[model samples]
Target: MKITLITTGSTADKGPRKVAEYLQKYNHKLEVIFYNENELRQTLSKCKNTDLIVVSANVATHKRASLLIQHLKKLKRPTAYAGIYAALHPEECIKETDLVITAKPAETILELANRLENFQRIADIENLRLKFNKKEIIKNA
Candidate 1:
């Protein structure tokens, strides 16, 4: 699954980076974007094609994360909240995102990704069966 992780604040912070690295090990495609460097339009555009989006925030970046989630919710896509802020303030994060990783962000994300992948695979098989049935019906008619 393609996953996009957005974080605000200084580049020196390693929480987001570490989460991204762990996800990559599980063969999920990851794009880590530092939101401060890009316009909101640019950030959203980059996220538009991703299967899942995870926004990382701490006390210093929670405002930015909230703003981004507001915009992201409009896209009607799956969004998750991660990082120290989410773990510490889950009630607030739950208001903004579909999923909140209150602890073990990496492990939680990996599980979610696996579930999504399995669902997609099942959907693809169902679609194929539907198409094949349609062709069979037409041929018989």
Candidate 2:
């Protein structure tokens, strides 16, 4: 799966980086973009082939996360993944996000990895369906 990580503030980068490393171990493609909220807006168009979008809250607050959620919702991406550190629950960050994984560093990494794997499986199935449909169309033609 091609994962795009949009991280705001300094602390938020750690979790996404760790998750990216873990996913890379499984031969998955991961791109970690560390930027403030303003920077994120400027580069939002660069997130291509992004099967999943993971946002970190340690760098900011629910307010910033909310802004991200709104922007992502407009993009209408298939998979919206949100995570928060400290005492914040996933619900506080973004309601439209597909899966919310909340925990401390150690537990968060484990849970995030599991969620990514599950998302990847779903994406794989979708890809197969598209391929089969295209083959059928070609055959009919």
Best by lDDT: 1
Q: Residue by residue across 1-141, what tens digits does model 2's lDDT show?
A: 666766665753566788777767866677787756667566467564576666666634556765666677666554333455323553333244554444443344344445556763422221011112212211100
lDDT of 1: 0.74
Clashing pairs in 2: none
Off by over 4 Å in 1: 120-141
lDDT tens string, model 1, 23-126?
99999999988887358999989998999888888998899889989998877677877788877877677667656776777777777777777774322221
Where model 2 places Cα greater than 4 Å from the true spot, the runs are 79-81, 85-87, 94-96, 104-141
TM-score to native of every candidate shown: 0.80, 0.62
- Number of the top candidate by TM-score? 1
lDDT of 1 at 9: 67
